[model samples]
Target: MALAKPSGLYPCTRSLPQAKTRSFPSLLQPKLHPSPNPSLKPFDATPGLSLVSSSAPVLHLRPRRGFRAPPRASSDPSPLEESPQKDATSEYGLLRRATLVGTATVASKILGLLREIVLAAVIGVGPVATAFNHAAVLPRFSSSFLGGVNGPIHITVATTLSKLSKESRRQLTRKMLNIMFLIGGAFSALTYIYADEIISLTAPGLQVLAQGNLIREMAMNQLKLMTPCILVSGSMAVGFGCLTSEGENTYLALSPSITSIAVIASCAVYILMKGSSSSSLNSPLLGVFISSGASVGSLMQWIIQVMIHKNSERETKFISWMDFFNDKDVHKLFALMLPATLSSGLVQITSLTDLYFSSFIPGAAAGLSYAHLLTMAPLGIFSSTLILPLLPTFSRHTKPSSLASLKENLQKAIVLCMVIILPITCTSCVLAGPVISLLFQRFKFDSSASSFVSSLLLCYSIGSPLWIVRELCAVVFYSLGDGNCPLLINLIAIFMNGILDWLSLSVFGLGAQGLALSTSCVSALSVLALLLLLSNKLGGIINIRDMRGPFLLLLICCAISGFTAMFSYRMLQFFLSTISILRLFGLTELLSILLAGILGMSAFYLPLVFAKFAGVFLVDSLWTTLLNR
Candidate 1:
């Protein structure tokens, strides 16, 4: 599965490379202030109180039944012609939604982990697995770029819909859905027909191997089977954008787990039918089965979203060809799609670049896939939960008068990402081997594979914070209605990434680790560029000097947590050998990881709790919930 983007929604971009997982991250903006016209009052926060900022997006907590839009007048303005001053205010704070998102997301992630484990047991990181991963890259990339949650389509829809009247939103959505259907259909056909050529470019190294042709054929077949996913995903994104704009984050957070479940079920069925012998399970046909499962999952997502929309008053209808031609909103949506697609989709494109390089290295493609699965878990959960709710808020407060409040909220968001992600990164880097082994060291997944994936995971972890920061910064630009800045920066980053990939693999000889390393380096550059440009655009809204103290404190705290966890794990491992009860029961590895993780978390949180930083609120809430439970 793709890890949701740091922007706070499910991003298929980080999804599967093994399944060629490509995902779009989610984007949410803040609540809007009441319109001066009595008939046009927007959703509001409770009287005289706001959450985090005056510009936070208002969430529609209660689902309205039979909600009807105001009747259209003869003089009703075209959505494209409307230019209202948008300002958002949240009745509810981020904490409540964050809690809901966190619970659903964490559960989803756990299920995703289980899916990966099942895949490893059935396929291992062998040639078949590598081929499947390679084949999946193209379709997943296309789906995520075009129709995945938080992809350009979703962003454009969510951003645009939030600013429109109910009647306009309903009409616009219908037209958009119809257009996406045609585009997605044509794209799917092209992908299906060109499967061989696509696989050749993405996994050229397969041709050089002894069984290269065999692997290549398998991948081509899998790609053809999965092509329909792109078609279904496009419409799915429109649904997600609609739901997200209406503040239906709970479903958005929960939806991805369905994909994982479908994949797992497919594997279970295959194992049952073919028998569980390693040789029987290694057939290329299993990969095809997995691809079919992914397609089914995509279709299910679209269907469920359609059902949900039909229930909502904002149900979409098929627009006539003439209406499609006449609507200016359709033209406007397409205009936003181009820059947003490039900017939001660079992560997948970058992965394709990395995959092209990886094709030359044996087992490298599969290794990268396995490693990324672990690295993306926390990012998908925390980032989507924390940041996704702020997009509307940012959109509403872009005026000069609200600049200071916007800056403060942005700073708070960045600080929270650092406080949470940094500690987890440190802990993961120190405990990479254990985490990898604990998750995927059974059946067909051997000890050697675990060791290989561990190194890649460590490299991927080093850049986790960079990924979060870059996406967070990008969202700020997007909220400011400046997609061009991120688009331009990403274009530059891609070239830089290619050069670094060449240097890391061809020159430094880092192998698969080199791919992850190059990615981190490129993200760091992008993050810096985004911040500097954002500063220029916002009149120095953010200052490096002001953040230095908090940054340093976080780094120190993370270091301490890492060391403490490492020490605890090692000590536990040592004691496990001497304790007859534990050794006899075979609880050594499990207990060691458990205790170490708990201690590490405690070490990280206690200091920040004492520090009285803004991040403390999150910690305090989580701790309170755990204690009460």
Candidate 2:
């Protein structure tokens, strides 16, 4: 049938003629004989399909198993669909990004450890170290939680940016960057101006100490130097958020190492300048040098972030007045920040509470800081590498239909966290003295300091697993869109922590050890509360009866490892004393810790291996299942 032409009102439409039948080549159709044209060849036929061509010059093919026909030339467009090749490419890109992030994260952690060791060597647990720790409490906490990678600002930026189009993302990012700068500048100025009062408020116990006035002065000076870092950190966080959205995480992960390097260089320079001949440098002067390094490091991070942003194709003006005041997204970002700040602020308050209590105990602040660094190193590795992978799994299983699967995953994650952490916790608890002695007991850091910090480390290690559990539970709550629950729980925990801090000092007379113990106790209670709430929310996520056996076995294995490591250390230390030569330069301490640690790990894992081989599949197989996940 012929089609009619368009009317004047529909001028774009054209007339159509009757179309000829375009039959696809089939097995039933006879193949055309060869043509003399150079482009036409019999061998050009695809395997499993026969080609046919005629005088009018149409190419056709027979449909066969495992063969797809090419699309016929036409004026019509093909419908859009997802492409497997594109998915594969995206997955490959994601894998590459994860690898880069993981590597840089590990490097940053290593440098962080180096920074701690260097600080311990350079300053020891002296007045300078104590004052510096006090001054850094607020800056470090704010920069890390409010402005660091994965912080409130970073998360908000990444989340909001992901939902926007390219142009919208650029606009949102520009507005956010400008607003952060303004807010950060205001904060820096305020902190600098009020540094003295801030220090006094942060560590009131300092007033009671014999050298309290001197320490206070140093702290105020250090706080002022570090004030500008608050500003730089806020802007850097926004930059990190932008990089994260673009999947360029290498610099975001590694930039922290730069700060550690700068601090280390500063310490080295201080050591060289002082030389042993002038070992009595003024504490306040030393504080200035270290604080200056930190400030410079932070500035360098922001500079690099700015350079990266400028080099980007979507770069915007650095300080846009219009965006700062008029942008809705900028306002939205700050609005989002309020809740995040409150939630994180509660946690920091608890830490400051401990600092306030520890100030009267001389080097308690420094000791706590060092012990915390040690406790977090291993936990950080596990959290970043293993537990973080579970977020997507949690997200996927959030549907009502997959509630059972979510519950099962939660159980597995808890058990796996225990399996991996319990051994490390027990080992650390048993070898706290040797570990601290080997790591930090050096030129300035003495036996007394190691003994003091070892107690704190032991106390901190007991609650280490609980810490991981709390993080996991928080992750689950966040995945479920119930972040308020955790926030409320943390608010209660802060009050509880304050009460415990006071009780430890006034009631128990436990001093710094009491503070650490109070933290552990609070952690245990918090985990129990979170679990109970989680169970109620999900109609019970874990079966206590089902997990009792595995949990018991893990505890037993960890306990045995602890005893074995302690005994090994005792025997090794005694043997080293008989040799005398191995005692040179802390070799005896290092060797004992290393050898005992190996044996302890062996004792822990060997039992599990034997259980698997002997067909005792309860604990061993469950852990293996989690590991495979």
Candidate 3:
């Protein structure tokens, strides 16, 4: 008896000749087509149905005349090829990787916060702390713009390497590393030699202070100590990109904690030697110790990253030194790096501008630093985890054929960022005072410091979402191979930031808080301009009308969350006032902040779920992913 063909199975050709009958299990059938050449061996098609093509130009389905079908020839392509389902699975894998990276980032950020807390307690917002903070401007900028996970150097290396062949990438990595090392070494030498001049230029107002000479001297020494960071910073950034591209994201995501630990250890040693004595807390010696710790921490960061890159499975062969200047890919990296580096430098210039204006006001720089730490804790976690992973995906989708996918990804990224960050920004703004009090209002960090820092924190909070959007938008520009657009945007932003800084400080009498506000305003305006330009570039990929609904919803949710958090905090504070025991050691403030944040987030999330908002889907997906792991 003839066996029936499996349902939904059909031959690609209509004409065929009769052949021998075959009987086999239906499920094991291999779907195949007749070979054009009759001399070719017969191949299985739908298991029981084998296709045998003859010289007569007709194909025949027949029994295999054996119990098992012949093995697929080594020369034949596999039956399983790239399909939509496979592509989806690959995308899912990328998402899983991103989720893992994000989780590690959160852990790292928590450790970083602890490190900041330790520094605040040990150093306080005194002269030494202020001087260290000011002197750290250059090093901090270098790390953030160069060695940072999403910095210019990192982005350039990651983007360029993704497009090159395996052998080409190996050649390029060695060349880039060689070039960066030389550049970094020269920069470090120059920085070390001119530390005094750089400090004088950056913080000229320091010379007019009561302890101007002491502060200036300490700052110069601190700058000298941190000069080596210029060398390490470039290497670290390139290593981060290399490791991440090779799928070793855990190391890059968690490496900052190594630096944090190093700083914490250094502070711990200092505290041990001092024996809880506040008298010598802000001494010049302590400043030197902290500065040295910071430099050591940076060196440690570079060492760990380099080691990880070397040990990774994707390690490349070391190329000759001449290749550094001759490789086309290395030159492309330089082309991309130049504009990206300039863009990042402009951002640092904003920070420098703030420092310059802040120098006239005592303790303002330190307050700004403290406030910035709090703002960055959440931003860093979200950006490093979410934005960094999406960058490679974005670069992959930059081709004209994939523009639609790129547009969708960008829109989703923006919406997701708004959903997750908006509530935090609102809560921070509302509970700024209590949060700062709980975190830093202890030991030498007094109530005055808390007040000033809280004000700056609140102002900085207003710009948190803006900062995230700015970063995401920049990633889009970078992915599209147009780093100059972001450069231009930042240049304008720096100009605006400077003008606003002057007006807020010198004219409006806002002090440090005004500086923070100016940054927020500039970031907000810059992101809007960037979005407009990006939309035009992509043929109106962003529809303002479509965005308005989600934007409005998120705004409402944030406002509600902020109000609820404020009310909850006030009620808790009132209740704590009635209980004397709860007021000790900032217990009341701590409890209030915890309770307020919990209630606020609960309120913020519950409404979104009830309303079935678009953002809720992403939240659900992320939560599900976490649970599955």
Candidate 4:
């Protein structure tokens, strides 16, 4: 709109004309496309918005003597004066941002891996591991449930931030950050105050380690030690989220790697200085202390984000805490936040359920942690990389332009996750002993720990893809500004998981593996719910029916490959020594897996390649007749 000049008749030459000699740098505006609104009927007479373009006046900062502007006095419009530059981060601009954000996210995931490996080797799934996991998860949970895309509150935030001016936008951002920080602080105190009680509730099985008052006291002390992270990291993440809204993503994307690097470096020094002994609390506690170093790492991240946000937007100013509370944006945020929290929070609670099921047996808690380390690795690497980065992409999209972009992105993301993770999953199933030995053989990770941890790792891997799919669906719902759907889906999963976990433990006697299995099942169900629910809302951008033949073929391939891997591993194992057998078994397993996979592909694709769905008709008929309800 080039915003019309405010009503005025100024003394031009008497003072100095605002436009005269004012620096005029070529402020290349955002390359915006006309996003046609597909949600509304074209025939409807919409007199208002059609005259106005969706794109705003994006002030692209050039390395020049600032912009030559018709500089008005302090009497200028307050909105433009106090707002962040309105630059839309779009899929069209993905390449431009590749170095800044894409590279940074890649770095973060790599660092996260180093962090997990160090934790497993040094901490070995003890109380310290459990404590650190809870502490670290606190901020992440707060971020997800509050401003994260998966939560219901995300819809409101996305819509509000998308619709509002830079000034109004900052108004809400500051308010939301302050309110969430206070809530995080309260949670922090609760975590610290009743740390022992919270731990017991969270991990009933792990409570066996304490005697008399020692247990309670130890849990409380650990909780207190970890509590501040909830406030510090959680509050910092709010700024990160706002920066995201402000179109500055690289700083946050690279922050995880920085945090992990700090933890890894500190832990390496701790391991060298303290040595790897678990006879007393001091050794393990050193790891805990080093783990706390991540908070410091997070601080570095916060500093970077704040600097980037400030540099990106010069008009931003501090928001008053009192004035923030009175704003309608604050009230609307919690309204959105509570339900969104319920949805995303349910997913977080699954970890607690995992803890509950994992603690029932000796070494179960630690074993689950090791398994979770593996599970979270790929998830954190890819899904976290994609979800947050793509959220702004979705926010800018108000049209039904092409689900192809998102579909392709999802397919590639899923395939990438599967490709990177399939080998790990196979190894967990077959080379559990060797893999655990290679990773956590040192310190307190004994033979039993290795076996149980490997089992849990395999079980948890089953849900990894499902988790990503659910995340994608949640993003769709959030982008559409409907948070209740994902929340409802999660609510169902929570109910299903609790039931499934109990049955898995009591009926199947699967122990930690059962907990992992239940999680996998619940996650799959959640993904299904999200797909079904969002398909209806987005008016069927996804074509599940189109992939029916290929999907069946993939399933057939998976089953065949599973059996081949198992049989090949066994045959190879029988013919060699334990050490030599693992190597041979791995080789034969890979060969058999490849062969079976090819057969499955041929079974489905050969027909499609030749334009014949009939090739899989027999299987489809059987599935429809026998499996159809």
Per-prediction TM-score, please? 0.84, 0.77, 0.85, 0.69
Ranking by TM-score: 3, 1, 2, 4
What ranges in model 1 sit over 4 Å off? 1-92, 144-146, 622-629
Candidate 2 structure quality by residue, lDDT tens digits, 1-629: 01111011101112223223233111012223333234322233222221111111222323345644346467734321112121111212222334446567778889999999888877888888989999998679757667776555565565456446788788878777776788899989999999999998989988999889989999999999998789877778788878766656668768878889989988878777775332544346777889989888888888888888888965656765864687777666666556655666786787888898999899999999999889987776555443334444455456686666566556545655666677788889999998888878887788999999999999989888888788777666655656567678789989999999999999989999999888888889889989989888877865566445445666678878999999999999889767767865657877888888888877876765543311122234334444543
Instruction: In model 1, state the lDDT of residue 283.
Output: 92
Q: What lDDT does the true structure give each of the candidates?
A: 0.73, 0.70, 0.75, 0.55
**Which should have the higher TM-score, number 2 or number 3?**
3
Candidate 2, residue 560: Cα displacement in angstroms equals 1.6
Tens-place lDDT digits, model 1, residues 208-247: 9877888899999999989878887777777777776776
The most accurate candidate by lDDT is 3
Q: Assess candidate 1 and give its lDDT.
A: 0.73
Error of 3 at 615 (Å): 1.4
Ranking by lDDT: 3, 1, 2, 4
Candidate 4 lDDT over residue span 109-128, tens digit each: 66776666677777666655
Total clashing pairs for each candidate: 32, 0, 6, 3
Model 4 residue runs over 4 Å out of place are: 1-102, 130-140, 143-159, 209-217, 278-284, 314-322, 398-434, 541-544, 556-629
